[model samples]
Target: MISMSPLLRLALLALVASITGWLGGRCRADVGDFAPCLPVFYRCWPPKGLAGTPICQRFGNQYRFATMYSRQRRSPWFSGYLYTVPTGRRPEPQLAYAEADGNMVPFPPGPLDQKVLDSQAVEPDYINSTYSRGHLNPSLHHRDHEDRTSTFTLTNAVPQKIGSNDGPWEVLEQTVNRTLGEYCLGEAYVVTGVIPYQKDERWLRDHRVAVPEYLWTAYCCPDYNNSLPKELREAFPTYAAIGRNDPNSTEEIVPVNQTAKTQFRGYDVRRMTLDTLETYLKDRFTTAVSVFYERCSGS
Candidate 1:
């Protein structure tokens, strides 16, 4: 075999990075003109149809986590943060802000200039709305106090119904933590996002934020223990899930259980293989939605 020249090797590397968005073991941070300034270990799989504004969550002049927000929805299309099961009590929720690429001023407790940061969702937007300020990146997923606190930014939230947010959806989040914490041997890359309606979109009470019809999440764990439980044989390499955000949504994707308690009757979570999840997403989005490259395969 012939050896490649140093210049030739460099050129090939650049080509790979451009196509795959994988650089130095982390997904590229620059998604469309915005640099989310993600932590070194964080990964991003930018979705189609939405403009992403990268948020490097800062508190007390320290970088905690990162999020890719959507201005059109006035909420996060998705947020990426490292996961670690907490060791102590979950931190009290404290809403914060990001200046994007604008000012260096610290995040204050009250209102912020929406113009400065490519627009952000404010606290008042959800004040009287029936939906809860649901977190895309939940606080319970991290161990550090600041890391958990960083998840409270409104830009990282969406208008989620209490039935889904506090019920089955919350259970899914906890189950993920337990699963990853016990089975995953190394780092696990997770991406949580939303799916809008094909037509006749739903909006919040303020009409400024769009409410998602379905909430979807997937995780890629390339490294894991081989000694697996009989039931978890297919859960190792990767898995995906979709939960109903609207009770009236069609039962084709997630079948509603009429017998479920009143609070969680219509909100049901369906777990499936990554490919299965993608099929549903493509049908709804009218395009392929690739959550992870090669389904986070490892040889």
Candidate 2:
């Protein structure tokens, strides 16, 4: 170590303070209400309302971040997929926006052209023995034409269950949408997906594999009904989540349900700070949000 005179030491202190101040300013400027993350997820600005809603389009590999809710409301199957709905169903674009890529591949082929084969009429040949033509993302959550159609793709699908898809699981999806739409006020960014099959998992057939043993979700309400009366918050608490529910399920499947309020596959519901939400999205959706703006144009 070197010793310095009192006056020299004072000068060094001043220099250090100046450098610290400059760095703080740079950090604040570089991070203005938004940040980025990859691998697990991504983050963008707070979602907007119908009027001038922000379009955080998910494109490229990040498209996979769009969660799968239910492939078909009528069928008992659910899975995961990568797709995008118009940021807003408005006649025109919001003109100002930001986005982050979610995990998965990019270059999404847009919503599934129902014409590829009538989803209502017949299941396609692609519905092979290995997998069921499951809907990764549920169609009910989508309020617009594009969102509904985008959900029909083979990629936005997974092998799920008739019981889960058609029974309790389906009820859960609808209940979530209604709860959010009513409480959050039109459109909640709900990303739902599956856990996929493990080697130990049994298959319905040699081909039709067992769907996700559980579902995972992370919801954020950065600006949840700021205008609502404070007292009503409990009736409409803006934050919640769960891991898995072996509770109330068949005794063979979920054994701990007799005393528990709900089963826990991995239910971890709690309010998240803005910073946490950003980190969550960035970690979940690794690619950028690519807004799909057009209707099906090709055959």
Candidate 3:
């Protein structure tokens, strides 16, 4: 007969329970604000944590939370469409891509219950005390109904600098949307979010932290012939670059520092499949992660 120490038995039990919990929390139908946009559809908020857990429960799709993301950190709760708009068509007006509506939707206020709390708090790895919510995958990128509507999920959020959000960040976002609008065809699944804040704490109290000094983007176009030359092929080569909104920042790019700002930040872009995106996210989040998971994987 094998004898196991009491502590060892308890630790093993905890691990098994955690795995079971994560499996149970897996999304059903990808419902809520995070549900995938099928064809040309417009809706707010997926069923539940499918759109990341941060702010999904706060408000459906009307307004999005700052740092609380849909999936990736610091990005908007992305929900966009891939459809055609008829001439003289009218889409309902909504808040600005960078600004909040100053409205707080109802939810159980105060500290959420342990179960709900677990799903609600931001991850510690990327989460910080003073940084403002920054957006990587800007809401502007989702121009059409399908993609536009999904940006409200909480999972796509992260801490960011106000300067970053209101400055170069905006530039990167607009450029991506405009360029994609100008070129590319078929569907574009853009997954963007902030790189976690490094040690020094870039964000000032009550101020924002600049997200990636350089924005990174990966896109794929299976049917991209309408805009560019036919030689471009269905798999359009992706793009990545360094950009600076502030003239005072450095020209040499690197990861952002907590106490200082860099002028140039390197970006990496490539073509990736949805499966690849999911795999990447799992590694970043760590464990069998979900919007509601309690573990904070931030380094």
Per-candidate RMSD, Å? 5.6, 15.6, 13.7
TM-score of each: 0.82, 0.40, 0.42
- For model 1, what is the C-alpha lDDT against the true structure? 0.75
Point out where model 1 deviates above 4 Å: 1-51, 59-63, 100-118
Roughly what TM-score does model 1 have, to 2 decimal places? 0.82
Instruction: Give the Cα RMSD of candidate 3.
Output: 13.7
lDDT of 3 by residue, 1-299 (tens): 88899999999999978754543433233343333222221112121222343332122443322233422222333322332221332333232222144233223335534542333323332455534444344446554453344433334444544565565555666655665665656544343443332333343222222233333334433344555656333334343333332233443443343443443232212333333434444443353313211111111
In order of listing, the candidates' clash counts read 0, 50, 41
Tens-place lDDT digits, model 1, residues 115-140: 73346666667888888988988888
CA shift at 264, candidate 1, in angstroms?
0.7
TM-score of 3: 0.42
lDDT comparing candidate 3 with the true structure: 0.37
Candidate 3 regions exceeding 4 Å error are 1-116, 121-130, 144-150, 197-215, 226-235, 241-299
Q: Model 3: how far is 135 from its true place, Å?
A: 3.0
